[model samples]
Target: MAPQDRLTATFTRADRVAPTPLRSIPQLRVDGLSVSYGPHEVVTNVSFELGRGESLALIGESGSGKSTIARAVLRLLPSGGHATGRVAFDGQEVLGISERGFRPLRGRAIGFVPQDPANSLNPVRTIGAQAQEAAALLDEPDKAIRKQLILETFAQVGLDTPLRVYDSYPHQLSGGMLQRVLIGLAILPRPALLVADEPTSALDVTIQKRILDLLTRLQHDLKISLLLITHDLAIAAERADSLVVLKDGVIQEAGRTASVFSSPASAYAKKLRADVPALNPDRYAALRDTGFRSLKTGQAPKIEVSAVTKTFTVDGKALTAVDDLSFSVPAGTTHALVGESGSGKTTTVRLLLGLEGPDTGSISVAGEQITGRSPEALRTVWRHLQLVYQNPFTSLDPTWTIERLVREPLDRFKIGTRKERDERVREALANVGLGEHLLSRKPGALSGGQRQRVAIARSLVLKPDVIVLDEPTSALDVSVQAGIVEVLLSLQATLGLTYVFVSHDLALVRQLAHTVSVMHRGRIVEHGTVADIFDNPQQPYTRSLLASIPSGGNDVAHMRTRAFG
Candidate 1:
């Protein structure tokens, strides 16, 4: 069937299935929601109705103004962004409401959960204080009542040891834990509406599922309306009741999740879904039988770590980050170090790159034990190993241009002269699907995906024997991720380079890695072929990880329940 006809059919099915809109009442009404930032109109004529306890997903690529429309609903536009549309919540005109009146409606009647928890939370204040503050905002004047409310709220979000977590600061908790705290605070007031913008993007697959399940439970039990803002259509399809596809501030398609996913109505929607990268069966078949076996002949050890371990002392208490972890990457092969946060994945990579010293174990590169080496000794080995970090924003120097950023690594290694380095930088940029025009722009000027490509370009300039990709695609969109993966594959083929990929994204890992290593806490609980790990994982932890991956094949329909008024 034609893409447009299919999308229309899907949307038509949703319209037929959904109950007719009540003339008297709608939980939230956004009519001709237009938003502009100075000279540019970010979102134009956006309209949607969210009934009581209904979920509406706002999905699009980066810079598509999905977030803008979401923020406009709360009148929380970024500085200089103006809105010219009627946003009514619970029959009240929200955009027309006074600041004093809006204050009560914001946290009590409607709650917001931003994308990044680090930015949402206060680093210095304890989580208890934050939770208490959230409860206090509800006008529960009594001290005892507030304390009881906060503790109960924390418990509702599945936070284990509420007392301990309350006492701990934001920095002390992991991303998943912090997200739970955010959920606790948002739901403390029992708000009618909850707007979550990419709430689980920073989390691992397991944590993402836990958060999704928690949100689903909350929506049903509390009868809360949800407006989920995300770039992931898979997440939207798996969680939302209604899906609204947006591109360049325009609505491309809107319908029930199942209808839109099974058969989209718009060309844009079809294109977007087609762009999502699924696991390649042929690649999986090739590596499914290759368990934790030794490398084949003519394979050079581009990156080798022999029994690496790391320990940290916090408040005089010792904690082991990694325990005698050993792995090797042969030339032209990709070795993935799969683990959750704090599993010592980053620490292991740091040691291999001579960025830090391991407490116990030696690291060998090209047959040389480079552990405990001097700065001079490390410099020679550093040229052979390059790293592409997870957060491209923090990795690239904001002050430098893309050209300078890509050229810095070459100059550091003294690979070539100024003109030669420039040529190599240009070549690297092209390899990553960027051009010389982007070279003049600073890291801040580029989009998230573009910034990451710049980081990749910089790493590729060295043409190292091994590249350590630390969650390279975690922060990017699926289409951008697919493009980046292609670039990495091409580089591997052309340069005969090896890769050590560290990521919490199981789907991405399964697509790229030859062998999978499932880590829990600080150790690998399972190491084997991708098929062995996915189809029949031995360890309970491994099985849990496998089960947690959000797939369309999973029984999500049963989990999706709309709350009634």
Candidate 2:
């Protein structure tokens, strides 16, 4: 049978089996759970419970064992990983079950949505093929009926064109679309519990809100218990009924979301709350006031773009990626370009970096014309500008040690003697808050935040006047993001560095940017001071973006005022 037909048959069988109803017992009870790899324990004596139809959030920084606990509950751990704990669902023990015994409950009673859709999806298969295989797990004999159910589920999850989406490959879909596909597949079996692991972490804010809303609606409508794993404190506070904060593999705090946010008992929990950009807007605002030096009245801007436009051709069609874009960054202040995916933010950055020439207009870096410059000339200009990319893991060469990665820029630029180069690397690392002990380590040895610090160190070693940061802290935990932001602010203050910050996160943009430019559909729709844009947005698009930020009605503005007043 074809993939679509096979998928249909699978859902048809799932429909025949009625979903397990909520019982008197807790929906899920995890007691004294411990997960270890060899002799190294990661999750130690973790315990939590969820009542029927309730939602719980597992939150912490990277390697805090949030994902480990989730995987352990699902029996999804890899080889050499051992999980010992009492995990019960609806009064039945889930641990110590044979593979054959666990097979029936894997998808039928429990559903899982992984962190990265790209990682979880089969790159070689079409969307329909994967959906079909997942549905077939239901063991439905009727192919036609299963297909109908799958299509219906797709529509229910907001995929209006089920046929088109089903036929498309994973890469053909947007991150949001791919996320919905995963949700559709997860809910096809009508499982009693749904475990969403960082489901929206990789998406833009607007898409993240939509996905969260979708999950909320599904949980309510289906009466499904949800276990959400995330590093975002705001999301946990807004989405879950209860919150569990973990650090170093141990539970720091767990309680009702409102109660925890209002009066967090643990220092770690309090730190997590304070680190959230949305929760503590004044923290960054204060840094801007106290630390930042004012620009000279008549000084030339560090970077300027005038009437820039860029276009690309796809399948014989010309598509404008950036249109008449113009913005300027002062000598030592941050200018943020905020937009959703496909809003031309990346194209604008490429234009600024001279990675691509504009079809029209001009770009100037450190008051030097760069647009249409020869490679040799631009190479000279590149010494004054550098880019810190979104993902440090991918950007840093894994084969090279930290010392080599930091020194590569100095070596490439041929600046100073060997001793001087080594000193520069050490100075850069210190500026980013990394110690010399990490110098001998590779990218694989560092944490997510540490890897990013190394990336910043490499950029700083060049002593560039302007650093274009592309979503630098988007992948980090709330606390880690706060630390990175502090480092950036400190470096900017002490070194007089200019930054062109590009991000989809409006909250972070509001915190760091002196000037803000809102981009939509390859055009700058709004531009103003951060205060004017955030406090009193003029454009409809800008207002819409601000309104889309997920707030669990926590009165964040009031919280900020009270805390920072």
Candidate number with greatest TM-score: 2
Every model's TM-score: 0.90, 0.93
Cα lDDT, all candidates: 0.80, 0.87
Kindly report which residue stretches of model 2 are placed more than 4 angstroms away from their true locations once superposed: 1-22, 290-299, 554-565
Error of 1 at 347 (Å): 1.4
lDDT of model 2 at position 472: 98
Clash pairs for candidate 1: 7-264, 7-265, 8-265
The regions of model 1 sitting more than 4 angstroms off are 1-24, 277-298, 561-565
Worst 10 residues of 1 by lDDT: 9-18
lDDT of 2 by residue, 81-143 (tens): 999989987677888888788778888788999989999899889998898887786667676
Candidate with best lDDT = 2
